[model samples]
Target chain A: MGETSARATHVQHGSHIDTIESVDAVFREQRKLSFAYGAVFFVVTLAIPAMSVWWKSWYAVPIWGGFTANYLFVSLLYYLFLWGLSWTYIKKADALDERLSHMADEIAAATLAAAEGGES
Target chain B: MGNLNIIAIVMVIGLTVFTVGLAIFVRRFTRTTADFYLAGRKVGTIANASAISGDYLSAASFLGVAAAVYASGLDGVWYAAGFAGGFIVVVLFIASALRRFGEYTVADFAFGRFGSSRIRLFTVVMVLLTSLFYMAPQMYGAGTTWTVLVGAGMFGLSPYQTGVVIVGLIIMFYVMVGGMKGTTLNQIFQFWWLWTAMFLVVVFAFTAGKFNYAKGLEEVTAENHRDVKTVTVAELTADDAALLASVETAMSEKGFAEVQAVVDAGDPDATVGVLIPAKNKLHTLRDMFFNEPGHRYNAFDQFSMVLALVLGTAGLPHILNRYYTNPSGSAARRSTFWVLVFIGTFYILAPIAGLAGKLIIDDAWRAGLAPANAAYVDGLLLKSDAIMPTLAQILGGEWLMGAVAAGAFAAMFSTTGGLLIASASAIGHDVYEKYINPDAPEARKVLVGKISVLFFAVVALGIGLGIPAVGLDKAYPALIAMMVTWAFAVGAGAFVPMLLTGIWWKKTTERGALAGMLVGGLGSFFFIIMNILKQLGHLPSEGVLAFVGSLTFPTLFTFPAALLTIIIVSKIDGQLPKNVDEIWMRIHGTASERHEKELGLDKVSTMFGNSKH
Candidate 1:
């Protein structure tokens, strides 16, 4: 029983450290990923209208089914663009939260100091 | 049209009771100004998302877009595409930002930034005017639908106008009683039925109908090539011929001459009548899409529409009001994201149904289910707004038609409720609370909101029921777009400019903000009036002049002008209000209480958090 307890303690320390490390790693990675994702999203959305313009009826088949397919294709791209952005946002949300919280702390300190000085 | 089928009647009645009951349940939440105007700002992401979808998709999307598609192929899908794509723009640039501002109404945001009561009052008048313009069309549509379905004229009033009154009353009641909470709950329910009914109708129409597209095309092609007057009546369908003969005989006996009574009475150049076939309608369709004097259906039109949709979403007062319902900006973002999902799925199916509708009518036309040239109007098989009603009939007969009719009512009511509520809040809370009675507490403000709702509803009813549809069908899209644009301009010019500057730029002055809003608002107004004048033949369509004129100068001109004015004026002024940074911190910060706790801040934090730096 004593041997088991010692083993468990060792494992617990290892896992806890691993989790904390992963959290820090994620925050670091998110800083870079957010910019990259933002760039890609901005590009693709800008491209859709551009393509639709440069080549109006690029897939113009005389058939109704063909037209329907084109419509669905454009709509699917739009939906995918939206969902992808939301996913990217969610992924970096933790890092964003931390950064924003730090900014809030600074603003709060500065404002409180000003208020106290004004009163004096 | 008065012959309501059992299925249609059941569906209609069931939906009516369900919606009314839903309204009653939600009414309990509207006891405070916060509750009435913003659903107490505690609504969940999914709930708010669904409600926003309900509010956004009006009678136009639910009924008119599909009908337009069914009537005119391909081109109608543009409306759906443009509208759905607008939400993407909202998600990217607008949703979270608007939520962060924490205003009760759009005008409040404007005045908050500008610190000018005068600017706020101008916005109040603009809001009322824009809301009325949007409200009138929905009321007109609702009335027209009822008149067709119930044959309301038999009760003495015109069927079209009576339909308007009934729909207007229901919308008013719901808005007045439940406020935003009521409107939100009711919309969530209606959106489901609207999608389901439309989906079922589309599927049924697709599978059950005698649709042979190739044959239909051949028949239309043949009809198009030949002079419509000289078509050979098929000799094989003797029984059908006899039936037609008997009907003609009966009509003649009833003192309606069956014989040739001026087969071509009006000038051939005049607008085509109801009995005209799909072939004849095709001419108008081609002309509308490709040959109209200044109608640009090319990529430029598509892009402009997308731009409108993207920017327009930001400007919509009703949509802005919805963001206030969520507890946090994150929740607002999530809700908006969900709304895109829900709306995207529904819009995907929308065009399919539209195309399917076109197939159904074209097929039926080929089979001679109608008169050689007759179109479906109000299910009487006349050529009018037949695409929607006839498609419903073709899909599931009278039952689906009834459901669609009910859907139409739901669409009208849900949107009108949102508009009325927004308009009411603008009058009741923003204008009344801020300037009229600065110390009116929250409960009194809520009461004022309710009264405002009632007043607007009565006015809606009066205009909807009493004012005859003056040139409704011919100018429907133009009118709807024009009014809706005003709302957008208010949002874009007044609210968006102020909020963006106030939050992001430290050098934004009150005077600059006010000037920006006026420029933006007045610019949109001017453009809108010009468009209207051009439409009414008051302005000559000088090709390049009209083309340049149509670009929403408010977006291009006002946005930059406002930005420039704010920056330049703020620089010249050389001073901002004291504690401006504190206010900026508060507005930019998360929910004040949580934000305070997170930062381990105190009472000073609340002031600093909301104060403008």
Candidate 2:
């Protein structure tokens, strides 16, 4: 088992040309997802203040269950939105990691095969 | 002590003993520095999530958020939203990277990243300052809890002083003995207990009060007027006197007589007759009871508060330290996800409790159930912090009050434990082990950490005792909440910009980090000082100084300023460390990749010897 693992590490080290690019691709993808989710969060949260300033009377307009839009939004819906955003981000980010790892392994195997073929 | 409720005292004692016992049980496992500091990096998602929730939900969340909601309606919910919203930012940007770049404390990370002792020292100062500021409010909350629970001082101390000392000592004993492993377990237990106790109180309140959400909303809103007692009257100018006369003329002659007598007696500001809310056009019953922003903040203030809270979570040292204990970067993200769930559940219940306090306790007080000396001003229960305890007593009698009181202690104790550990680690690990004695053994480092815990606890106790004497207790009605915002502002200003830049910007130099921290930390610190002075009447209250001082949280300005400073200074410095790329790889790379790079396959295999091949 030790000899097999050592040979695997040697192969991985010899064919590391595409690893940096693969890692960068994953990082960029993750950053984009984070930014997109972050923008949505900021817009929803900042709207509370914006509506308060620009449309003051809207607060008094009753919404569901006799709660004014501002009341229900601040008290209930805001928390729900946060929880949803987190759940989505975690799922997507984890998938991204798994994809990146798979890509790394495939790249290493292809590189190893090419190196062995060239040697033969 | 005789005036202290027996049930509350017993409950408080029992909870304290239970926490101490848990700490003692975990102490045997704490044999190494890693165990003492990061629990040997063995914390799982659920345990760490609960610990994070316990650490994060301080007295500010437990008591202050409810009281704010009770006082300001929807404006109060903004506090809770801002708090939980901060973690979203954490989940997106900071949590995983922080765990991957794992260090014992924030200062350690800064030092490792920048490879500068000066940066490390600067970070240590900021960490200590932020921790102390954060801990101060918890100490005050503990004091406030005792005043409501026991009603008397112990061992020649005032009740507030006695409470602060007792909490500080108990926390010190546990944290010093158990370290991270023990403290984390204690926090998990405390969080659940507090959550369950609060859950029970809310259930009881909803049932006992027959609080139909729609009807309660209608009932509160339909009563367009609130009764406010005159706590103090501003001196009446000629115009004011004219206004008073006109107001009095509008009232019945008998009602006017009471007002005239107070004005005639020369101290109109004295605690006198109640102001009929119907007389004030600005405070219609609809506005008083309905959710609105202007109750506590204008649009600008509301925006600034949300900004402070969202950015500030990234900078809190206690919260940041928890990320270091995760086994992998992925685990860190999972834990943050759980933190969001746990905290969201807690926050959802907070407003329920606040509404119950308003619908039940404050309503009863207005209906003549309040003690004669209990003050009500501008629709505010003066002892707003006591609303939860009062609600408990009214709904389910002494036993419920005791339960709620125990929860309050749990909130304070858990938060204090986290803060104490953060500060002690800064002093012992960052300052002592890293600088003073780099070759110190693990046992000696742990010993030093224990001493640091004791020293800081005493300091916190002293500052807690002085909070009331400095008149903060009177100047700020929501004293706990106010101090907490200050801590958040300082944290956001000082740490957020540096951490963000260090992680994302390759050009973040040691010089830039130091300069940004100074600009942000000291800028917010200055604002806090000015605000305090203005509140205590040392500064003019009606001019530019007052306006600047009134920007109680300077994060809205300081955060941008700090970010700008870092960008500009890093541009000017035009230098990056050689290892910046490697560090970036560590921060953004997978845990498997990191293991491959840092250790060969042999080491990796050895590290995961128990795992399946």
Candidate 3:
């Protein structure tokens, strides 16, 4: 009984520390991904104004049937890009969360196993 | 009212009644606070998406985009683009995470995340301010619609004031009774009504008006390409004089005198007439849709407006509240995707409506169906906010006008309803339940919510009635869009930085969030108030004051200030909340994990809970 209690106490402490580290690591990675996505989006969206200001003639160039490059990009392409980025982020973020959850469960199981082994 | 206007009035009244009836029908289902605020968090993906789109497509979008395009051409189309692009930001950074946070209001999320009543209190203020700013525009739009459609006062009130009070009362009733579920249902219907009405107008314009899109483009482009010469006596050579003689022969005595006076002036180069190249006889689409910046925006203006819209969308309390209606984080993400799809489709139709309006007006002028003098057209120009309604009258007569009037009303009602619910939730759920009466019964909380809705409606109505009297209506030609953009700018400046940082950063202390909100909120408010003062002629009209005033949407300055303040203050106050990890876990975890953690359920049971079976 004494051995099991001591082992349980040690595993609980170790697992608690591991959980915090894991959560932080996962969160950091997610934040990095979010920042990367946000930066790319910002650059792409910023091009609308940049083109309007510095490259004035670019807006006049016809890219599609009766639509100028500026018109097509501003009206349609940017929205599609935003949608695509969001879709990709959701997919990847969901997968990351799933992996984190699985890792947490495994750690919890290992801690429980250590306690059981001490009891045996 | 004219027979045609009476028909439109009837349609508007019918729509209001139908919507109120729908709300009453849905009231039976809303027993709990969850149902009242978030429809028990059980809304389906498509329904919620539809509701979001409905809530989003305000009077500004329904009518203002069309008016903007008609007036400013491609520069106007940027409004639609920026609005649609904003949802992208929401989808990426806000939607799912907000849903996962599991809060009734944004203030609730702030309180939960920071564990601070002060932040919650501040959040309530910001949320109410944002929602009121948003709602006021819809109320203004409703008034505009009434003036154009009815053209008279009612019960000793001007048409504008009558419209404000009537719409306010109806919205208050439905929102108080139906809550979020009814609002969502009504919004979906409203979106469809708007879409269908717009679609019908486009179809009619194409079929009846014989709108040749390519030819129209070519003609407009060629006309714009022509070298314009001022029609003055000094500038007029022999050929120009002969052309001016022909133009004078066609003009009435008053018109001829107006032109002659310009010629008589010492400044003979007065812009009496634009001289086009004789070879540029053919009209093209490009000429009609002049694709350039100076018509409406300068370089800085476009960037500021776009930035406000993109960031402001995520910060909007009403929009964020829609996410709370989703069952799970993934569902919120899906709903946002669907919202993009729905709204993207809606925005594409707006410019088409504008193009159709232009063509109709032009054809009317050529066919002698319109008034002979330019003054009437000038009057119409002053009320450019009424372009959509005027177009409906021109293209499809009274019945079509009625349909469009109804659609416009729906747009205003749905947007107002959403804003009311959001404001009420902030006051009732966040402030009243949390701070005022912590142990208040669910029913009492809902009663408070209903009262808040009534209070907000009255406030909005008062502002709407005052707008025209204050000359704000005349001051802003695109009144609906301008007011809506102001709200977006304020929301972006105030809430977006804090929301993004709270969700993504662990070191975001309550003090940092508070500082961010105050700086951002007050900064945006200061700029907006300054601009208003400038408009009222109480401030300088040139230099930096004019430049700042000209921004219209000041998110460019305020958003960065708020974000920087949050970061700096958070770094200085290095103490992280004790429950940061738990909050992160709740926000970032999978459905099964969150369920397990929240309910203290075992993994197997959580797995079962997550499964379809």
Choose 2 or 3, whichever is better by TM-score: 2
Question: Model 3 - which docking category?
Answer: acceptable
Cα error of candidate 2 at position B11, Å: 1.3
Better of 1 and 2 by DockQ: 2
Clashing pairs in 2: B224-B285, B233-B269
Q: Which has the greatest TM-score?
A: 2
Q: Which DockQ values do the candidates obtain, in the order shown?
A: 0.09, 0.35, 0.25
Predict model 1's lDDT versus the native: 0.58
Better of 1 and 2 by lDDT: 2
Better of 1 and 3 by TM-score: 3
For residues B1-613, could you state the per-residue lDDT of candidate 3 as single tens digits? 4223767778878888889998988887787788888877767788888999999999989988887776666677788888888987887778777876777888988888888999999888998888888888888888877777876667988777777888888898899999987898899999899888887777777887676554554444443322222344664434657756654544546545766677667574555543232221112222323554445556666788889988989989999999887766767777888888788877877877776666676567556554221213311233556777777777787677888889889999899999999999998988888779989887898899999999999999988888877767655546788788888988998889999999887789888988999999888988887777777666787888876776666888999999999999999998787767666655653433344345542112210011221
- Identify the candidate with maximal DockQ: 2
Best by lDDT: 2
DockQ of 2: 0.35
- TM-score for each prediction? 0.76, 0.88, 0.84
RMSD per prediction, one decimal?
11.0, 5.1, 7.5
Could you arrange the candidates by TM-score from highest to lowest? Answer: 2, 3, 1
Chain B alone vs. reference chain B, TM-score for every model:
0.78, 0.89, 0.86
